[model samples]
Target: MSRARLSPALVVGAAISVVFVASALLSLVWTPYDVAAFDIGHRLEGPTAAHWLGRDHFGRDVASMILLGAGNALAVSLVAVLLGAGLGVPLGLLAAARRGLIDELVMRASDVAFAFPALILAILLTAVLGPGAINAVVAIGIFNVPVFARLTRGAALSLWTRDYVLAARMTGKGAARISLEHILPGLASVLIVQATLQFSLGVIAEAGLSYVGLGAQPPAASWGKMLADAQTLVSVAPLQAIFPGLAIVVTVLGLNLLGDGLRDRFDPRLDEER
Candidate 1:
């Protein structure tokens, strides 16, 4: 087997993702200072040898907070995407296999889901379930469901019309078997690209929810919460906000670039053009 070619964007994106993942993992084991520890004297101090990214208004080490915050962001995004893809992929596959009323129903349900924005859905869920990381994940996951479902349905529909799919049908292969063995494999690249894009969106959605006090609660050290806290002290200590903001931007950019790279790599039309 030949090794797959790596795109420059994919390499850079993967590097960025690795760095963040490593930081998050390291934070799980150790942080320079207690993420919750506060010192009035050190509050809002600029970066120093002792505290690389300085301290927040509460005197919590910004670097430590960011490190741990990465973990929170990744965890939420990962769960959200998993939940979305887990349910959405099946529904999409089922719809594609059945077509007619089932497809209409699935697509219509997705439309209804798309009608509500993530933030609004988050707020609604928070009202019913109260605020936390799980709620945020559910909200984001719900939002992602329609996206994957639509993409899967479209991709699977195309595959269903192909000669191999017809041959499998003629060979007495059930829809479920054919979808699992054939359609799903063909849709893997597309799903992967979609997942990357959705993961980034989930991260941003989690941050937005957290910023609005609907995500990870106090002492959790979410990037969004950090930004929310820093907004009041932006002028006095811009780094507090800057560090978390930069984290969000870098994470999203990396995922998006990775998705683009994967799309270019997987799409045959793009290969033909090259």
Candidate 2:
């Protein structure tokens, strides 16, 4: 098979993702200042020799919080996507394989999920479970399930009609076996692209939740929470909001670009169109 050409979007997205990932990981070892430590003496201090990005209204290091926030955002989004794709992929496969009522039921359920927005679900979940990172993950993950299920089911439906699938059926291969071995593999590229897109959505969802006090509670740095905290201070300490805002924008853009690139690479029709 011929190697796929790397697109500019893919390269740039990868580079941006690498920077965020590296900063997040590096935060595990060191930050300019302790994330939780605060100093009333230095509240709202601008960039200087001591604090690179300056300080928040609470006198906490903005740079440190940002670095740690990257980890938080990445963790929550990663778990949300995993929960979504893991359960969604299999359910979709089952629906496609069984057809008839099974397919209808699954599709209907996805519609129900789609009816409830992620923020609404997060609010409800937080009300029931109390706000935290885990609840954010669960709420976001639940919301994501329907998205993956629909995508997977749609992609698998196409694969089920392919020649190899017919040959497998002729060889006495059961629906489950064929789906696991053949159908799933055929849908990998589509699923991957979908996963990347969903991951960016997950990050945004988590941020939105955190912004409203439903995610990664107190002392746990989050980009959304950072924005929330900085909103009032924007007139004075704009850097506080700016840094986190940029983090969210850059991360989402990178993931989107990566997803678009992957779709182009995997779908021959897209390449031809380009």
Candidate 3:
């Protein structure tokens, strides 16, 4: 691995990721005001002394809602990413370490899974489970499984041929034990890089789920839900859509850049090339 050091892209990406992550965390303890409390009297009012970002049609403070919604989006995305990584990484390692039938089956299954997009999967899940945040997570996570599995398998395969791994195999160690002891450690940098990229995609998937009434429900205050609510009212009050849209854009872009930075910093292949 290359030495850990800051680049311009890394600094900017980390800054954006931190700001949004802090905003999400802050909502757990506090917001500008009560997000659920309605003040119809102030509905659609422009930004004022009391309402910094103005109030929506429901009279809920836009800033407060955005803050709360940040929490929703982040939570959903983070969980989905973790779910994918947790399940997919192990499968990849097992396939790589144990090859033969296991490798064939895992790779074939991943190809099958790759066929369904997150939105399509979400719709299928919503049909059976009903639309909710959990369904959105499941949908996004299932889609991500193939992504992580393929990447992990490819990365892990290289590690399997390493001198340390070949030596481990000579000791008559079981595949699982060898994978855990020898190969898993070597795959961390690749997994971390992939996780960051998937996390950004998860954010978008969560938002899209919420937008279509498949994720967070009413009063849950997800960024996508806010956009859905404000779409029709854009002519009446454009800022309603603008703020949440910007939130999604900035978050996704930052995560992508962060993933890029990690790739540049962590990829030994890239280092060798450079």
Clashes of each: 0, 0, 0
CA lDDT, every model vs. true structure: 0.89, 0.88, 0.86
Q: Candidate 3 has which clashing residue pairs, if any? A: none
Shift of residue 57 alpha carbon in model 3, Å: 1.0
Error of 2 at 123 (Å): 2.8
lDDT ranking, high to low: 1, 2, 3
Instruction: Write candidate 2's Cα lDDT for 76-148 as tens digits.
Output: 8899999999999999999999999999999999998888877787678877888999989998898888888
Off by over 4 Å in 2: 1-3
TM-score of 2: 0.96
Pairs in steric clash, model 2: none
Q: Write one digit per residue (lDDT tens) for candidate 3, span 1-274.
A: 3446666677788899999899999999999999779889888888999888999988999999989888988888899889998989998988887789998999999988777776777677776888888888888888888788888899888888889888988999888898888788888888998999888988888888888888899878898998998999999999989988999999999999999988888876777886
Candidate 1 lDDT over residue span 1-274, tens digit each:
1127888888888888788789878888998889766798878999999989988887878888998999898899999999999999999999999999999999999989888876687678776877899888988888888899999999999999999999999999999999999999999999999999998898898899899898999879899999999899988888888999999999999989889888878888877666
Write down the lDDT that model 1 would get: 0.89
Error of 1 at 19 (Å): 1.3
TM-score of each: 0.95, 0.96, 0.95
Return the lDDT, model 1, position 113. Answer: 83
